[model samples]
Target chain A: MTAITVDRLHKTYLVPEREGGLRAAVGALVRRRRREVHAVTDVGFTIEPGEVVGFLGPNGAGKTTTLKMLSGLLHPTSGTATVLGHVPWERDRRYLGQMALIMGQRNQLQWDIPVLDSYKLNQAVFRIPDADFKARVEELSELLALEELLRKPVRNLSLGERMKCEIAGSLLHAPQVLFLDEPTIGLDVAMQRRIRSFVAEYNRRTGACVMLTSHYMADVEALCRRVIVIHHGRLLFDGALEELVHRFAGDKTINVELADEHPLDPAALGPLVDGHAVERSATGFSVRVPKAETPRVAARLLAGLPVSDLVIEEPPIESVIEQVFEATSAEVDGG
Target chain B: MADVATRPVSGRPDFSKVSFGALRRYYVGEFGASTANNLAYRGAVAIWVVTTVIQPMVSIVVWRTVAGPAGEVNGFTSAEFVTYFAITMLVDHLTFIWLMWEFEWRIRTGAMSPLLLRPIHPIHKDVCDNLSYKVIGLVGVLPAMVLLVIGFGGDVSGIGVVQVLTFLPALVLAMAVRFLLEWVLALSAFWLTKVSALNNLYFSLFLFLSGSFAPLAVLPEAVRTLAHASPFPWIVSFPVEVALGRRTGAEVWVGYLAQLGWILVALVLLRVVWRRAVRVYSAVGS
Candidate 1:
């Protein structure tokens, strides 16, 4: 079933146009003018129940605006959206109780109070039964390793610990749909992985639909099978991660280990050296070659150079996403 | 998402039965949490309480000293002045609405988005928060009330059981009026980014018009006439007047009707302003 349906969502903001200096400030006080900024324009997408989708975009590229609209935190200027077949802005209590929007930057947990107290408050707001509330709290606490943190005040917990509790509080009602905006924005790598796995496990257990937007590609790579790329308030790509890598990453790297201590001269490796970086040792070098030219470059290097060890690997996913953004921007500029 | 069938979304939460239970739980839980919150920030609370009571306490001392030696200025004795200030403290604390904080938050954090998304009106949460503070404030205010009565020699001979009984409903109406008006003011956050200056202007008007600075009787005849029409006097002055037994017979009933009227007007204003604010906020993409 389609859990979320959005069509031609457009959001425009009226931003005040103020110039610098004292004179302009005085003039603004007299007659203020505004410029209309199109944050999200003609964006459209749908998500099926139990599907995990990754939303990717650069900063100020309308990723958050689109997410906010989708989660019903925002209303579109001239489009329609429905979550679980109800208009989000209507803010029906039932809809609120069933769906959760967990933002990393803004915490929902009550500060200066124990995490359990916040959960209890959520229970009241969501009207969760006592038995279900207890069982779910226990389950979420165990999953997030929040056994000790539950008793401590939210203000006392570190960012990572607090985020875990935030996630737990958001889910105490077992919201069918979860909208996570950078759920691991500031966590260390291990904590990020832990959160990613926890989300995957939660999805597996409850079959909840999740739409996550993150700057971290590892989050997308690990948890999301299908990725939706949005840029400049438009959907640029919507497909598998593998296809994204294959389509965007047109190059591979070739690493070599020299038999003896000798630095390779760039003058000698003409036409074959797109780029090369030496390991700390003078005997080793890593070279970047276009995927189509990898075979030729490697063959030439092995035959003509005193190489001992060699390896070829794909570029990182972050590089692929960066390339996607670069390509999208170029296309936009060309148009 | 988990074959979790869509539940009924629009029906009310059984206001007659389950709501009572929910309200009970809400009050108990919210009170406990707020008490802990206030305790956790005891220093800040103490500072705030001191700042809050200073003006009222100072005015009482001034009026008491002015009405010296057998002490009765415009029919209010020294003891009456003490009771008036103490009662005003409790009344002001009860009716206080931090529309300033509410508006700033709705604007700054963009948390208003989620609030606007709920099926229920967001004012319910604000109402809960308002009451939660009072629930916690009772802990400090109760003892403080006793100390003021003993130290300043307040007289409650005129405070009958009927007056005490009527005070509850009167206070409820005052809260309703204040909440509706303040909620309308909070909606300004949606239209304007810098609303603090406007909010300051509002509080200044409220201070003068509400008899917070002085009893409505002390104001000039013209200002008193204006105060009668304005909602502020009805919110603070009428309640204090009734408690002090200053108003009686038909005027007391008139005060009750005035509160109801302001409530209705404020409710209408809230609806109109909220609709416009929602439209503006959604248009601006906050």
Candidate 2:
């Protein structure tokens, strides 16, 4: 069953215009100007129950806006979406009760109250029974290692600890769908990994559909098998993570370690590789070649050079994503 | 682990079918939490109570001086003036709603996003917070009232069980009318970024028309008529007069009917204004 289906969803904001100056400020008092900003344009996707999908984009690519629309926090300028069989924008209580939205930069907990108290408020809001609330809190606290932090006020906790508590509080009712927007943003590497693992484990245990957005490629790599890439408020790619890398990543890197500490000559590689793309160290040198030509180039390099160790790798996912965005922008510019 | 996690919690009811019993429990929980949160800022509560009490105290002193040695202005003696202002203070405390400032802050800081996401309407939480603050502030209000009555030699000989009993419904309706109307006004923040000037205008009109500055009878006939036409008198002056036994017989029943009329108007206005505010907030991206 499909947990979420968004069809041609769009959002446009009417942003007021203001130019800095006393004259402009005074003029604004009499007549104001507004410009329409298309935050999300014709974005559409679907997630099946138990599927974890990553939403990838650079800053202001409309990822969060799409998530907000799906989670019922926004009313789309056009199009429609349903979560767990109910229209999200209609904000049916059943839909809201079954889904949770967590924005990493925004907090839902009461700042002055203890984390446990905030959990109790959520329990009331979601109408979770005492026994079930206790059980879910226990399970989440154990998974998040939040036993001691639950009693402290939210302001007293570190950013990582507060985020863990936020995730825990959002799950008090064991929602069937989770919309996590940049859930690991601003967290340290270790904390990000912990949250990623916890999310994977939660999905494993509950079969919940998860849609996550993050700047950290590691987060997407660890959790999402499928990714949807958006740029300039448009979908550029949507498929398996491997497909994303394979389709957008045109080249591969080959690192060759020489038998001795002697330097390698970039001139010798000739037409086999781009001479400028070759970087030589004291012990080794690395070269980039078209993915289809890696094997031929490796053979020629081995036959021509004193190679002690050789390793081949697809370019890093970060560069591939960067290329995807660059290619999309280039297409837009050309169009 | 999968089985345990996937097992639907027993006794869980559909949102549409949620029982009133469960809703009551939820409201009770909210009230308790709100009260506890308010108690954490006891110093702030005391400051609010002091400000609330000082307004009426200053009004009473100024009016008493105006009465002079003969002690009568517009048929209100010094002792009667004391009684009127003291009751006004208590009534003001009961009916005050700070949502104008709160809504501005919430909109500016993006705090309204989480509220919009919840299954419940945001107004219920705000109502609970309002009541909780009043409940905690009563700790200071009651003592201040007692001290004023003693220090000013306020006369209560005219007060009886009937007046006290009549005051109860008036106070409740007044609170409802003030809260709903102010909440509607607060929705202006959704459109206007700066609401301090609007708020100041509202409070200034309320202060003069609600008889907070003096008894409505002492004001010019035209101003008194205007006050009665507006909802401000129903919120404060009408209730204070009822508590002081100054309004009785047909006047008392007419006051109740007027209070009910204004309350209905306020509720309808709130419903309409809140819908538009949410639409604007959603459109503009909160």
Candidate 3:
């Protein structure tokens, strides 16, 4: 079953135009000028039940705008979207009860109260029974290691600890669909890994559909198997993570380690790989080759040089995503 | 993505239709939580109490000086002025709604987004918070009322049981009228960036028209007539007058009827304004 279906979703804002200095301020007082800003345009995608999809995009690329529309915090300027068989913008209570939107920077918890108290409030808002609420709290606490943190006021907790509590609080109702926008934006690597693992485990246990947006590539790599790339308010690619790498990442790096520490001539390995430069190091040299020619290039390197070890690796997912965005920018510039 | 079966999760309730019992439970929980949250800010409440107490105390002193110890002004003796201002303090404390200031902060800070995503309407939480603040504020207000009565020698010997009974409904309706009307006004923050000037203008009008500065009869005939034409007098002065036995029998009933009328009008205005405000917020992005 489809957990979410968004088709041709668009959001345009009428921003008041103003310039600095007294003259423009006085002019604005007499008659305000507004300019149309298209935050999201013609965005379309679908997420199946139990699927974890990464929403990848650069800044101001409408990733957050699209998530807001999916979560019903925004109404599309003109388009349609449905989550769990309900139109999102209609904001049916049933739909809201079964979905949770967690913005990493925005907090839903009452600042002055204990985290557990906020969770209890969510129990009331979502109408969770006492027994179920207790059980879920215990379970989430254990998963997030939140036993000690729950009793402290939310403002007293650090960002990582607070984020863990936030995730736990949002899940008290066991929402069937989760929309996480930059769920690990400022956390350290360990905390990010922990959150990623917890989300994967949650999905495994409950089979909830998750759509996550994050600037951290490790977050996407750890939690999501499928990714939906968006740029300029349009869908660029939507498929498996490996497929994204393969399609957008045209070149693979080949590292060759020689038996002895010696600097190698760049021209020696130039013909083996393409005309790409060979980066020399103390014990090894690395070269870039086309995805399809990596194997041939490695074979040639092993036969042509005193190579002790050789490794071929796909470029990092971050570079691939950057290339995707850069390619889009180039297309816009060229067109 | 492959198609998956639509299996209903266990232990999930049918939230499409919320029952009254569940809603009551939710409200009770929200009220309790809000009350606890307010307790954490006792210092802030104390500061607020200083302002709340001083406003009425200053008004009473001015009216008492105007009435002179033995003389009466606008049919209000010095003692009657003390009673009226003391009761007005309590009545004002109960009916005041600060959403005009709070709503602007919520919009500017993007705090309204989480509220918008919730299954319940955001007003329920605000109602709970408002009630909780008033309930906690009474701790400070009661002492202030006692001090004012002791210091000013307020005499309530003329206030009978019937007037006391009648004041209860009037106070409740006045709170409703003020909350609903001010909530409608607070929606202006959705369209305007700076609502402080608007809020200040509103509070100024309310201060003069609601008898906070002085009882309506003490004002000029034209201004008193204008006060009666607006909902402000019905919100504060009517309840204080009922408590003071200044309005009796049929007059009390008329006050209730007028309050109910203003409440109905405010309710209609709140509904219209809230819908448009949400539409604007959704369009502009919270």
Candidate 4:
């Protein structure tokens, strides 16, 4: 069964606007002006149960907006969505009990109390049976290294520790679907990896559907096999992560390392790489080539030089996503 | 889950039924958590109770001074003034809500978003929190009430069995009416956007008309009539008078009916306004 289905989802904010001037401020008192912001427009996608999907976008590209709608914290200006066979915006208690939405930047735990007490509140509200609550808390504690931190008040824990506890507290009910919006945001690399792996483990154990958004490409790379890309409130791409890289990553880099005996010659090597400028280092030179021509270009470089080491690499996912965003931005501007 | 981690839960509690037992369990659990939270911040709770206690003490001193050594101003002797202000302190502490002051921040910061996602209504948690704070804060407030009464020579001789019996229900009803009224007023922040000035105005009117500043009998006839016309006196002053045996017989029944009427109005207003507020936040993301 499909876990989440979003069709023609749209959210437009009627935001009041005024120029930053005394006269405009005075005039606004009598009559205000408003502008429409299309936060999410006709966004459509479906994820099967147990599917882990990356939701990628630049700032204000509607990633968070879409997640809020699916979690039933929001109702779309227009369109329909369902999670686990119930319309999300209907906010039936059953649907709410079965789903969890965690935002890394915002906290829901009571600040003055121990983290475990907050989890108890969730248990009471979600109506988790005592045995299940205990087992689930134990499993999450073991997975997230939360035993030491759960007794501390949330205000006393570091950001990373609080986040670990936050994720664990959110899962006490064993929600079937988890919407993680930058769950590792602002954490150091080690903490980020821990959270990423915990999410993966939780999904693996429970067969829960997971949709995640993050600025850190490492998070997306490790957790999401399928990715959906959105830009300017529209779906730019939705498919396997590799498919995304293959479709949007326009070029590959080829590096050739030579023995010290082979003197550096930027002039003579210019013609070998289709006359494209060759980037040089003390022991090697690398050339950018279209992904389709990497083999041929590598062969020419190998045949031309006494190469000690040779390497070919695709651009990193971060750069590829930036390229996708830049290209979409250009398209919007041009149109 | 059984495939890997642990056995399937044997008993799935159907909380969806909204039965009385389920509600009791939910509230009991929430109350425990809230009480724990209140205990964790004992200093803050003590400060809150101190503030509640101090206000009535000031009223007592000022009103007693006006009443002179053994004089009676508008039928209120110095001792009777002490009694009225002392009772007002306890009732005010029981009914006050911070929602009117902090709700705007909650909305602007998106702090209330998590509350919307929960399976249970947000008001249930708020009620639990409010009750828990009062329960914990009473540790300080109850003693302060006794001290103020004793220290100020409050006239407790007039308080009879009927008055004590009736005051319990009156105080409970007063708490309900005042909390519901303020909760609905706090929701005005959703549309008002900036509510501090409005909140100040609300508190100012509440102080004057609720008889916290002085006994309604000591105030001018017009002010007393206005206070009765509004919902303010029924919340604090009427209950205080009922406890002091100042309001007797038919007047006591009238006060109860008036409090019940305000509760019904407040409940209806709460339902309508809360429905629209959620719609606004949902339609246009806060």
Candidate 4's DockQ: 0.50
Query: For residue A197, what is the lDDT in candidate 2?
Result: 100
lDDT tens digits, residues A1-335, model 4?
78999999999988899999999999999999999999999999999999999999999899999998899887789999999999987778888878899999889898878888888878778787676778788878888889898888899999999999988888887788899999999999999999999888888777889999999999999999999999989999999999999999999988888966788777778767877778888788888888888888888888999999999998899999999999999999999
The regions of model 4 sitting more than 4 angstroms off are: B1-12, B282-286
Q: Which residue pairs collide in model 1, if any?
A: A91-B117, A91-B118, A91-B119, A92-B118, A92-B119, A93-B119
TM-score of chain A of 1: 0.93
The runs of at least 3 residues in candidate 3 whose Cα sits more than 4 Å from the true structure, single-residue gaps closed, are A266-275, A292-300, B1-8, B283-286
Give the winner by lDDT: 1 or 3.
3
Each candidate's lDDT (Cα)? 0.79, 0.86, 0.87, 0.87
Candidate 1 per-residue C-alpha lDDT over A1-335 given as tens digits, one digit per residue, 9 for 90 to 100: 69989898898887789989999999999999999988888888889999999989888789888777766666678899888887876655666767888888886677888989988877776666786777787778778899999999999999999999989888877778889889999999989999999999888777789999999988998999998888888888889988888888988878888888666666776654644543334667787777998898899888888989988988998998898899989998999
Candidate DockQ values, in order, are 0.34, 0.53, 0.43, 0.50
**Maximum-TM-score candidate:** 2
TM values, all candidates: 0.90, 0.96, 0.95, 0.95
Show pairs that collide, candidate 4.
none
lDDT of 4 by residue, B48-166 (tens): 88889888888888888988997989899999888888888898888888988777887877887898889888888778889999888788888888899999899999898989999
lDDT of 2 by residue, B63-107 (tens): 889998566999888888888898888888988888999988888
What TM-score would you give candidate 1 relative to the actual structure? 0.90
Every candidate's fraction of true contacts kept comes to 0.25, 0.43, 0.46, 0.50
lDDT sort, best first: 3, 4, 2, 1
Give one digit per residue, the lDDT tens place, for model 2 in A1-335.
Answer: 68888899888988899999999999999999999989899988888999999999988899988888888877889998888999887788878888899989888998878999889888888888787888888888888999999999898999999999999998888888999988998999999999999999889888889999998999999999999999888888899999999888999999989898665556667665645388777688898889988998899878878889889999999999999888888988999
Return the DockQ of model 3.
0.43
